[model samples]
Target: MPCDKSANADPKKEFFIDVITMDIDYPDCILDLIDNSVDAYTRSEIDDPQIRVTFGEDSLEIYDNCGGISEHDLLNTVFRFGGHVAHDSTDTLGIYGVGLKRAIFKIGNAFEFETYDGVNHNIVYENDLSEWKTRDDDEDGKWRFKVRAGAELDQETHGFSELRITKLKDSYKKMVTLDAKIIEEISIKYVLFMNRGLSFWVDNLKIEPLFNFEVLSNEYLQPSVKLLEKDGLKVKIVCTYNPRESLRSEREEGRYGWNVFCNDRLILLSNTTKETGWGELGNIAFHQLYYPFCGYVFINSHDVRKLPVKTTKNGLVTSDNTYKFILNEMWNQATPVLKYLRTSRLMDEETLIKDAEKSANEKVLQDSKLARSNADQKSIFSMNEKASFKAPDMKPKRKELTKIQYSRPTVQVDKVKRKLGAESNKKVGELTFDLFYDEECDDA
Candidate 1:
C-alpha cells in the first residue's frame, strides 16, 4: 500500500472557546430565563427571595438578587447546555442549562444579561431568525447569533442579575394589558414559595399571599410514624369538610392531591383523579366522622412514585391499596371527633337555636356597655323597647296526621264455641256445683 497520511489522522476537531446557541420561541424563551433566575436565587441561600419583572411596549426586564454567576464561570460554562451546577443533585433546583437560552429565544429578538461577578461584566447577544433561515455554503452552519463584550459591571451591589429582552413578537403585544394578572396567577400557582423565601413583583404591585395555611408549620400535617430504614414508609391522613356549603358541584368528581415537595422545591403534583379509599369513606354526609374538607394527606420524605398511582402536575391516579390505607387511618382519627360533636349537641337544631338566643342576649348586654359613650343611647334603648312590643305572638305548628284505619282480629269465637259440646259441659258443671257451690247457692 502507498503511504497515506490522511488515513491515520484523527477526524475530530477541538475548540477552545465555550459558547453555544439555540433558537427558542419568544415568551417561552423568557420563561426559561426566569427559571434560571429562580435556580440562581435558590443556590444563593437568600431566604424568602423575590424576583422583579418590569416591561413596556418596547422592552422587558427581569431582575433578581440571587447569587449571580461568576465572571469566569459565565465565560466558560453558563451558556453551554448540560452545564448546570445542580445537575443530578436532589438538593438544588436546576437541571439542564437549556432554560436560559430557551427563554431568551422565545421572548425577544435581542437579549442582554448582566451579572455581578465581583465586578460587572455584561454580555449582550442578538438573534436574527431571518438570518438563521438563510445562510450560504461558505458561512458557518451554526445558527446566527452574535455575542460581544459589554461595559463595566458593578459588583459591590450584593449579588444581582438582569435580563432584558427587546424586539417583541406580535403575540406579546396583548400581554402588556395582562402583566399584573399574569403575575398574580403565577404567585398563586407557586404559593409554596412564600415559605421558601421567594417573592415576586410585577411593575409596582406586590403579589398577595394566596395560601390559607403556613406551608411548613400548618399546611404540612404531622406524620403518624417516621420511617427509620430505607424500606420504612410513613403515612399522613387529613380530612376536612364544609358544613355550611359545598364548594364544588356534585357533578364534579375526583381526589385532590397536592404537589409533593422535597427541600422546599416541587418534585411533582399528582395527575390522578380516582378517589382514594379514604376519600370515598370521608365523603359520606352521614359519616361526619371524617372531615371531608379540601386537604391532602402527604406521605412526606418518601418517593410517592412507589405507590401504584400515576402522577402528573395536575392530579393523581390512585390504586386500591393507597386509598384503602388512607381511608382506614382517616376514619380511625375522625370518628371520635364526629361522635364528640354529635354528643355535645353541636349538630342539633334546637341546641343551635338556644345558643343563638344566648349569643343575642350577650350581644345586647355588650351594646349596653358601649351605650355610655353613645350620644343616642336613650333613643337606641327606646327603639329596642318598641321592637320588643311589636314582636308578634306565634305558636309552633304541629305536623298533621293524614288518615286513620282499623282492622278486625283474624281469630274468631265461633270455632271455640263449636269445640265445646253443650250437654257434656252442663253435666260437668252440675257435678262441680253439688260439691262446692252448696253454700253460695243457699245465700243466693
Candidate 2:
C-alpha cells in the first residue's frame, strides 16, 4: 500500500500582503516608488530623465520619462511577489522586485498603471485590494493579476509611464502631505543622479541636490584617494578635509565623518561610529579635534548581490565579507588624513581667537582655497590608484610639553594650595613651578 497525500503548505496571500507592509514606514514607501522610476531610467539609459511625484487629497501619483515596462515583464514579473526580472544590476538599486507591490499595498487599496513605450502605446491596468484578496487561486495554484491593455491615451500620458494609487490608508495620509520631508529625503538619496542631470519634482516643486561636502585642494593640501578591488567588488575611498571647518554650523557639522554609497545611492551619511572604524584599529576615537576629517567610500559591483548593502538598501550589511574589507581599507586611507588634521587642529587651537572678524577672514581663506581652478581639482579626482595627501609643512616651533606627576602628602598639598590661593592641587603645582621658573631658572 502507498500513500499519495500532500499536506497544505501554501501561504495565505492576504496575510503575506500584511506581513510585507507591516515593517515599512510611509516615507519609505514613497521612496521605493521613486527608486523604481530612477532604476527604470538607468536601465533605459535615457538622456532627459525626469520623475514627478504628485499628491491628491486621497491619492498619490508618480510619473517618469524612463522607458515603460515591456509587456512581457509587466505580465510576468512586475506584480509577482519577490520576482526579479533578469538584467544588469550594476548601478541599480532595485533587487527583490517587491518594492512596487509593497509600496502600492502600503499606501492604498486601489491603483491604476498606464504605460506607453511608443509601441505598446496607452496600455492601462487597474486593481483593487479587496477584489484581489477575494479571488481564489487559479489552475496552477497561484494568484494572478489581470492586466488590461490598449487603452486610449490620456492628457497626462507624456512620460513612458504613470502610476496612481488611490484610497490612501489613514496611517499614510499625513506622511504624503509632508512636501519638505519627502523632498529632503529624495535629495539625500539621489544627489548623484541629480548631479548627472536627472530632474525630480515633488508636488510641482523641483528638488535641488543638497550641496555635498568637498575637501580642500592645493599644492600643500591634497586629499588621499585609493581604489580597492576584491571578490568582484570595487571600492573607492577618499579621505579629505571638510572645507567648512572654520564655520561648522549645526548642519555642516552633521556632515563630518564618513559618507558611504553603493551604486551611486547614499546609504550612510556622516557615520562616526565604530562600525566605520572610528574607535577601532588603534585609531583615535571621534572628537571635536576631528571635526575637519571626512571620508567617502563608494562601492560598486556588476553583481549587486555581492555588495554589502542590506535588502532595503538604506543600511549596510556589516556582516558581509565585502563590507568588512571595505571598512578596513577605509581606516587605512583615513589614517594619514586624520593624523594631519590632529596636527593642524592643534595649531589652530594654539592661536584660536573668538573675534568674529578673524573667523570671517578664515572663512574667506577657506572659500578662496575651494575656488581653485577646476583643472587642478580634476587632477586630484582623476587619480584612481593609491595616493597620499600632501600635507602642508606648517608645524610651528614650540617647547615640548611634559607631564610632571609627583605624589605629595595631602596636608602639604592643601597648605600649598591655600598659600598660592589655588583652586586645585594641580593649580598649586603650576603656581610653584612658575615661581621657580621666574626666580631660579634664569634665561639671562
Candidate that scores best on TM-score: 2
Off by over 4 Å in 2: 122-124, 150-159, 253-255, 346-381, 397-444
- Cα lDDT of model 2 by residue, 156-215, tens digit: 654488889998888877663566778988888887778778999998999988754445
Candidate 2: residue pairs that collide: none
Worst 10 residues of 2 by lDDT: 347-356
The local lDDT score (0 to 100) that residue 189 gets in candidate 1 is 42
Cα lDDT for residue 308, candidate 1: 30
Worst ten in a row by lDDT for model 1: 386-395
Q: What does candidate 1 score on TM?
A: 0.51
Cα lDDT over the full model 1: 0.43
lDDT (CA) for every model shown? 0.43, 0.72
lDDT of 1 by residue, 169-281 (tens): 56666665557555654454445555455777778677764543311111112111211212223444333222221112231111223233332333333212224332253
